[model samples]
Target: MREGEKEERTQPFSSPEFAPVKLGGGISPQLIAGRKAGKAEKVHLVIRRLLRQRAIQEGKAFLDLGTDSFYPFFQQYSATQQALQALGDYAYTARWYPSSFGLLQLREEAQRFLRTRFNVHIDMEKELMITAGASQAFDALSRTFQGECFLLPDLAISTIHTIAIANGARPLRIPLHPVSGLVNLQEAARLLEREGRPTIRFLYLNYPHNPTGVCATRAFFEEVVAFAKQFQVLVVHDMDSWYQAHISGISLPNILEIDGAKEVAITLLSFSKEFGLPGLRIALVAGNAEVINALRIHNSEYSVMLPEPCQYAALAALQAFREDEE
Candidate 1:
């Protein structure tokens, strides 16, 4: 109110941060509407109502079981508690931005986790990079390689289709084999052939697959590797649910386990569903150093870096999981 004193300016309503992200060719209105429709499907509504009714009858809270979240079980783990304490001690370091690739210790522990649990080995510095989450990594990958077409499981999570559409790529859904519930390679190949295989750039796969819960066999992976090599298509294998296989005493095959897989495939690992740390937003992309480097560079400009605290917490959780295995 004083003369010569400037008024306190309010932040503008519109800023660069609020601007719409132009993913690749740019996200279209149809893609946005499809994303919304996918999220508000009737089945989701029914499940939410059932959960509420169950919670009311039981006189207790219920988490969204549809998400396959394990936070309730995760919090009770001794390792989780220890990790939380350790994370609290180092939380102040969050004042700084962690390496776009993520923290070294976290990546190292991730390397060890893969080696010990899956019998797969990767170079921490070259073959792996930490992502904010599996979806973020997938989005970046899709944007980086906006191929003419993407081959996806007919029943894959909606995000896969949404990302494909947002990246200006045509999504061609392929059927699964009736007996094994694994992707039907013959059908996929036929579809690709029909679509003109040269336009096919990415084939997305998931195992201990979400919703359907199918696990891939080693032979199937061998077939997939051969198929990718033959077709010259890059395979993006999302093994985010790897822990589900461990819990079920099923030894699921990592695509990287297949010989020559790295030449045509990249695997994504997530701790969110496994460790009940979805809020932490940390995951890893492994295999194919060139692909990893591409994602690293793309993310540097267009992606938000994971904080140091999340990295420390992820490291602590990885250590705890390892100790429990021992």
Candidate 2:
């Protein structure tokens, strides 16, 4: 190397051999516009794909059970259609909101129906509220009496835990043992005593239990009532499936029938299972006046009053029951 001339500079660079090199300002306007439009089109394609996948995942194929085969012709008369027509005709006639408690006539009918059919007496004005369904009734009750712990049967429907959790309550499972297709009272009592506390605000009991087909005995219900009373715990008895199965010499016992039960129990019943009118969506809650009142207040704050059509339909059903008895 010459003294005046610096050593020749040398540098090494690394790059992929097959990589596409971008030429600045070399892409045409048309190509640039196409690329921009292509980005939006690809995004839309991806969105459509995701939507279709979700639809396929969630869609259910309809099954027709032909329920009319098991019902009397008159009993099968679609009250829902009649209700819709009635509502259509009276849509603008009144701005009336149903009582926060519920429609008086419906509540009376529910009370009278229970008294006559189940031999369970209730006060219509104070002990009952017409709910959209048993689900909403339970939801309101759970919200009203929010507690740290709930005692639920091990074989309970998923909704029991769901509602409890939504209301910030923890559920403790109580295993249900079977004795001749009824909840084993001894086992239940043991579990109840073992899991229960002052913090346990509610003990959930369901008879003609869903999925298990187990009914509770009068003795079992009395025991539960006693336990609840002793502990000052509340009982939410689900009698939704009471009449679905016919058993000789078996009369469903309401928890409230036990002495001192009014201090510790509330019962829920639904027309869905009994009448095969699930879509009609009507149910009742009955119990101590204070508990019912709290439920009603919570219900009013969180739920819409039962639609007029549902109330009317329930009233008609109750009227039919009365006429049949005569």
- Leading candidate by lDDT: 1
Q: List TM-scores for all candidates, in order.
A: 0.85, 0.69
Clashing pairs in 2: none
Model 1 off-target regions past 4 Å?
1-27, 30-46, 53-58, 61-71, 244-248
Residue 86, model 2: Cα distance from true site in angstroms: 6.7
Q: What is the C-alpha lDDT of each candidate?
A: 0.77, 0.65
Q: TM-score for model 1?
A: 0.85
Candidate 2's C-alpha runs over 4 A off are: 1-95, 180-198, 244-250
Report model 2's TM-score to 2 decimal places: 0.69
Residues 138-211 of candidate 1: C-alpha lDDT, one tens digit per residue: 78877888578788887788777777676767778889899999999999988878877756658999987877
Candidate 1's error at 245, in angstroms?
6.0
The numbered model that scores best in TM-score is 1
Candidate 1, poorest ten consecutive residues by summed lDDT: 1-10
